[model samples]
Target chain A: MEGPPEIEKREFGVGEYGRKIARRHLSFEDERKLNEFLRTEAPFYISYSVGYFKFPSATPMENKVLLGSDLVFEFDADEVGLLSERDVWMCDSCGEAGFGYRLKCPKCGSSVRIEIFPDPEREEKLKEMVDALVKDFLLGDFGFGREDVSVNFSGNRGYHIHVRSEAVYELDKSARIELVEYVTGQAIEPQYMFGGVVPCGKDTPFLCVEGPSPSSAGWPGRMARSVLNALERGDRDLLLRAGLKRKDVDALLANRERYTGLIGRGRWPAPKMFPLEVWANIARLTAPLSGHAIDTQTSADIHRLIRLPDTIHGTTGLVARRVKDLSSFNPYRDAVALPSKEVTVRVRIAPEFELGKRTFGPFRDEILQLPLYVAYYLIGRGVAEWSLDSTE
Target chain B: MEVFYEVPFLAVLEKRKDLLPENPSNPPESVLKAASTHLRSILYGKSRPKPVHPSVFFTEANLVAFSPSSFLWERFARHYALLAVPAFERREEILLRHYPPSEVLSLKEFLSVQRPFPELKLYHLEVSGGKVYLGRRAPLFQASLLYRDILRWISERVRNIVVSGSLDDLRETAQRVLAPPSGRKRGYPHIQRLLNVTGLPDGRKRVLFYWLIPYWVTVEGKTPEEVLELANEWISRQGGAKIYSSWILSEAENVRSKGIKPWSVRKVEQIDPELVKLLRGMGAL
Candidate 1:
């Protein structure tokens, strides 16, 4: 073990009912204690801090000497801005039902309560975010190797990408903020990213400056490639969203083949037509295309609690599974590892949630035969209880 | 009561500087909204201008802002130029202290280094009674002519663009602007060694100010006027620092009055984190 594994909390958070634990220091011996807690308390929610401390049982957050921490990046599908079509909503008043996101029923004109379901589409979008973080941002832009990084499903609506490296372990809070700034592209000066002004040689009429290209390092490189990608694909919507004037958009596309050739080679043919402002606008707009939309505050919070990996998330009854092939990994198939024997459950109101190969529920006020895995998930959510005629 | 960092409602005034009421009696809605966002970013959620707490407060995380209301505005106004005037923008709310041109010049430079919006050309409030001109759009025009040649020369060196076309431009520009007052041209060796143009003037120019000011005062027995004049003459020779000529004098006064320092190695990031890089590059902190 790399020194005694120190933790800030024992078994705190919502796990306890109406009680707050005083500052308690804990050591690595808590691994045994952790298992003991898992066996005894059956904590609905368990969370641990991202970084490590010097002394075992690194508690009383202020006093513990911090050794280092892993760079943790989180992604939630709901936060990713993808609307879930899988959410089921029903008006209890008229028994009118609908699918997708809805606040009220159109049939009976009654307010409907939505039961959010596990969306594979949103999860797939989340996987893309993970790919962007690990591949594009970390390995490609930041130059971290695959060996330095790891990825796992949060076992619910998100995934956490942990970067364990010798370099990350030494960063202080200020340095961590800088890292957040770099990855997130917040408050970055455009001139600094790509050299703003050029020297005045033989007094020319207008302004002239070297252009950005894909090969350039850091933010400039990301922007350069994005601009080049737009040029290559002749993407009008992208340039339009970048706040480019319609004429400039038309002009770039008209000479799309030529701009693509130069930009692809990382050269800007700085002619009088395409000036710096247009490029600056495009750079600002496209820069976010390369940024990871993780919670800006969490990465820098040294005391922030994150879900412990490989543990069963109480609501989903799915393990916060370590993903090997993220592209194909689904929580239902990959994360679920429970008794497969069929059991009966008396469910109140439950949305169709994924269990293995199939989805079950939207089972309102009924007795249903469910596999133990499905039964556990519903039971954990408190929407279902063991049936009187139950067979385990 | 002594406050820690103290400018909140005032820090908002600093940000919405252009919108500052010519009279600090009533600032507009735009200014107030900005102030609310600035306070809310730190106090409520995660945003920046990370709360600069008062020294009295034990909270190290910058949770508390220095209260401008807590301090004597009349006295504080003399020290730092850009300030949020009382509950409203009133002339009497401030004692209307008439400062010399040097003190007035120090305001923008001093304020730029402290919270919210730190743009140097952010505001240039000129009051007739106060007889003080705050800031102008000049990291270039103030640094006109001979000093520009100095900048060209240093920029040429920083860029490592060996002579030929640019060198001829440098030489021609230098010939027109280069002039020093006669008699003992004793040559500033201390200044000469530390002269760096490896990068353009951003925030790092603070180091040059910190280093150059002391030499004019302590090393050479120059009066404040002479110190300001000598600074304009010597630092102007660099070419890039013309815009900061006024800032140079302002900092020169600040250095003398307040013991503002040329960072020491022992000091370890005491002021202007940007300068630490250049100062270290210069080998003397």
Candidate 2:
């Protein structure tokens, strides 16, 4: 099979390019005020939804703070290695777009423009992850309620969960660090969740059944229930997938009634006859899935400012719209904010992408007329340039 | 004449080089020397403003006896009580000069009689050969409780001492101690009032007087003129109240150390005029 596609590499003058796009697409008053506000406010740092300005003040205020702080998490198609599977990207340096992973330009070897487009499956997974973090961690663990949390589409690959609670607002850096650690499972000792190792004779192999008590709440309870369901199902393939060894699987199956009895009573047994290696394997596999994959730095930095809701994301030309009902929120349908004025531009490379309710083409080098938002998105990404000599 | 003499209530045990001694009943010269050295170290370590010496009585036989009525005894007995000697050793007597109705008493009686003192408490007692050791027991000082209660206690104690003393003596002592050295000027009216009211005494009172130095300098602004100016400014901004300068200084230091800028008006209100004036003069406002 062919490896990931090579897309060209070139660093665009980010601030200048952003300014150009803002000037062209945004109202003259909006562009002037955004610049003026940025110049005056002078935040510690300003990060666009795309790239960040390390010292925004040094270069004049070009970045705007979203009205509220954002907690962004990315499920990049390229980062998650799903470029070849579902999403597509275009090379900005040499206009080459396709439905495959491209790191460098095929034509000119310049940096590729990977528009952070949505995938239904990946998007679902991302939503589930964020929902669990909000519901289980922020709400259940930290005592935040539904009113305190607001979820938003980041207008690209991820979701932004903004927490606005007076209780959490004044938390210092160290307290925030602790909160991050708890949510991300940093330095969480397995021995803390599972009990100490049982001592068996040096010559004899043993397996220690140690996990959260079945009655315990949160991840522990969830894990316990999942393990119980797996055992009750008694599928050999499931057992194998759970990292049980052949010998251990046979032994467990043979004594299924006794094992089930122990589990039912919430008593984890340390059996000398069972293999210790198999238990360790199962623990290794289960532990990671139990931990919530949260962005620790974003949560830990108390001074961090996030994307403003209802503002347009520079990269995707879609609004970072707030989600009232997170369960039914679809970024593709709901986040489209730009006007639908049709514009014709040279199509370097366009892939089949779903915008609003329509699927637009896998167009090649030919010039094509597309909706204003779509054309602006491609232009902003530097994938397609406005045709100077085009006749409408 | 029955004279009251003060003495060391506790003795340090020394390390022995030889397992067997020439005199089984008495410690060697080297051991005695080491014990004396240890005693000296303890005396120096716990030295207060007024240093008191350990009282010792030498008998015709050159046996040393410690006095239980000395200030040292009172301090030590605040935590410790002596162990009773065995019945066989009851013949050995200790002389008490001023103790009522008893010129002589057995070591056992001495141990039991010592219990009458309220500061002394019963702990463990150990007896080996001819030597006896007393274990001291005192209530543990909880640091959290200490932090909360110490300031209030100091304030109450100082106020009581000030109110009870003669005004003339308090004024004289305040003038003598609170007066700035050489070209340095006297403090403000509030500080002067606080100083004049806080009466001084002998050596012990001087220590308490010095303990107020940090608060005095910080609040009163070194010179009397500057102190008055700052105090007036403070009174203008916030009305005056009975201020505990030390507590105010401590609170300001605490807030400043936390990296908060421009002290809050509420916090400023908690501080006395002297401290607020001092902090304001120092541009910490």
The TM-score between candidate 2 and the true structure equals: 0.45
Candidate 2 stretches with Cα past 4 Å from truth are A1-16, A19-84, A89-97, A102-113, A170-181, A184-188, A196-211, A233-244, A253-257, A271-293, B1-285
Fraction of the true interface contacts (Cα pairs closer than 8 Å across chains) found in each model? 0.00, 0.00
What are the C-alpha RMSDs, in order, of all predicted structures?
24.9, 25.6
Task: Tell me the lDDT of model 1 at B127.
Answer: 18
lDDT tens digits by residue: candidate 2, A1-392:
11101101101121233542221111112334445544664222223322122332232233422122223333333343334344456665555667666678778888865665556676676677667667766666445667777776766667767665555544444445544544444333332244345433335464445445456544344445555666677767767875677887787787777676655544455635543333333433444323335555666553343554565667677777777887888887788877888878886666666777777767667787788788877776565778775575
Segments in model 1 whose C-alpha atoms lie over 4 Å from true places: A1-26, A56-59, A88-98, A102-115, A186-188, A196-208, A265-292, A343-353, A361-365, A379-392, B1-285
Per residue, candidate 1 scores C-alpha lDDT tens digits across A193-285 of 332334323454433354455765455556677787787878898788776779988988998886776666545645456655555556556
| Separate DockQ for every predicted complex | 0.02, 0.01
lDDT of all predictions, in order shown?
0.54, 0.44
